[model samples]
Target: MERETLHRYRDIIPDFDAFLQAIRSERITAVRWNPHKVSRARLIEELEECFECVEEVKWYEHAFRLGYEEKPGKTLHHILGHYYIQEESAMVAALVLNPRKHAVVLDMCAAPGGKTTQLSALMENTGTIIANDKAIPRLKSLVANVSRLACLNVSITWNDATKIQAKECFDYVLVDAPCTAEGNLQERITLMPRRMRESLSRLQRNLLAKACELVKPKGIVVYCTCTFAPEENERVVSSILERYNVKLEPLKLKVPHAKGIESFGREQYGCEMRKTARIYPHHLNSGGAYIAKLKKRG
Candidate 1:
């Protein structure tokens, strides 16, 4: 991590030392069972022989936290589409969206389909999901995951989410916006360039605005990111609330989390910003994430 980046988070993150320690430690590997393809009980029974430990995620019935030595993807179950290797915190967005059966949904930036497939499973393949992404190349992975997961309800499209033609058509929309990826310290990737970070924040704002526009009145939009940066998380959602008729709704997640910051630097966001949840690596013993649920007012 950069010295400047460490300094930036020093004041904002409480227990900064623990946060630093957590990010530097090994990341927990987790996977969510594909209920569409297999029963959770049966999957766990099958994996019991292979894994030293396979414990269910208390918050999500279909998810399991694997032992450190477990290689979930290499298992026959994964090859057969019985499960998805997803970070437990990343699953929060789809769970927060809570797409109802037969409800129209949109995954604004749905490539590599972790949340997209999860949405399909939640809907039980009954509703339609317009899964759109700007990058055509990434669509292959998206398509593979959806196909593997047997998600027939999803329709893939290649386009910028901000420019999508559909308006007020979806009951639920997810903007798992691109961000600085500061929370994914487990990957050991370089810090995002300052220029790219600024650009991504702008893109996140536009995508979230479009999500608010695409959902029906009284519908829900769930915005989330894998980074700890408020600029990409709460701040972007705050910007959307200022420009749109959406109100922040409390996320009813069972997992451990920190409340979103109402004031970042001198700027104070709406009080409702506290409804958002911020998951740190230290808090969950997993990668970090931020999630906010919003409802569009009529």
Candidate 2:
């Protein structure tokens, strides 16, 4: 881990010591039950057989934290698509989106379909979801997961989300853009070069701005990333707010999280940045993420 890269967040993150400790701690293993395949009770019953601990994550329904030694991915139930081995914090995006049944939605950069499958479960497999990824190599995993989870209403596509030629075509759009993933400290930490971060920021802004264009008037667009960089999170979103007709909306999430920072370094963002939520490793004993919900104006 680059100490300097993380030290930059010292003043911005509350209880900085706890944040550092949580990032260095062993990652929590969690899974979300597949409502399309099995009932919660039945899945928990099955999970208990393989792992000694199967405690529900109180903040989110159908998600549970497993024993550190237990591998949920190896279980037969998992092979059958009974549950998804997703990080607890990663589940927040779909919960915040809350796409309704029978609505039209687009999941831009939806490879490896964690949130995409969760969206399908939330919509009860009734709505249409266009699951897309720009990278051709990643689509295989996305297709497999959507199938395993019984996401009957989903249609897969391969396209650069920023270049999609759709206009006002969806009721909801999810821009879970690719990022530096600084939040996944549990995996490994590496120095992020300034040039690379800037390049990703440009890509993120384009993808999110395109999402705003694709969503219908008064429709929702949720942008999220697994990194804590304000350049990628707040700055990119602030740019969109300036150019687009979308407004930030308060996220009615039940999970514990920090509000987005209004200022980062010398950059000053609008107070509305506070409406966005920041999930820290300390908050969930999982990974970190930043989520912002926007509604296109009529």
Candidate 3:
């Protein structure tokens, strides 16, 4: 991306060289969308998944324009489910959530069922996961995804992740709250960084409260976002601390290589920030992400 774009956020310190390398490594062609699939509904859905609706569509077409390259989904990774075509770094939330067998987990905002399915895998398919999203249309996709994943421990529910009942019941809740997604700017620059500040802050608190509210006494809540802005990530964690006695959970990331892990804080949420981890595109071959593990102190 652009330096001006990277300078605004604390997490991003992009290396254009590496960026180029990543692009070169990508299996998907950088083409625009296929003309045949350009309906309003399809466009909107892909936009949500890709975030960079216009450019991504263009890139899809651009890729197609180059030639009839094989789609990534049709590859072995999709069959193995080793890697998923998720909302970019959205997978981080599930990794951060880390559900255990016999636990009751709820993925608030679980439509498209990415995190929910992951949680099922994490729990060894022994725990229960209530996957909830408000949109009926999106719910169908969620159901389809969970079914495709063969997730036996999941139950599909149609409810707004924020306003639903079921307080203090879940052993763990992954509130990967909706935000303006500044980290997503590499693709969605049309949505500016400054404009995302307010939305990020607001959703942070709402997500924290909702997640904290549902966590069983002494249960853990992992809050995450794709955006790197501290106002959203840490401030949201801080807000949760102000309202409840919560402690940050340390993230043990052994797979992907990370850098400058110490650069972020320990107590931004009113306690030491030792138990949290944040990853940027610069840190590893991953999209930008902020992850914090919060335990309800009760």
lDDT for every model? 0.86, 0.92, 0.61
Clashing pairs in 1: none
For model 3, residues 148-222, the per-residue Cα lDDT tens digits are 666788999887677777689999988877766655555433434454676758866886888888899899888
lDDT of 2 by residue, 12-124 (tens): 89988889889989877999999999999999899899888889888887899995745678889999999999999999999889999999999999998999999999999
List the lowest-lDDT window of 10 residues for candidate 1. Answer: 1-10
State how far residue 244 of model 2 sits from its true place (Å).
Answer: 0.4
Residue 23, model 2: lDDT of: 90
Q: Give the top-scoring candidate (lDDT).
A: 2
Provide the lDDT at 231 for model 1. 74
Error of 1 at 219 (Å): 0.5
**Residue 25 lDDT, candidate 1, scale 0-100:** 84
Candidate 1: stretches off by over 4 Å: 1-3, 187-190
List candidate 3 segments past 4 Å from native. Answer: 1-4, 10-70, 75-83, 86-89, 187-196, 255-271
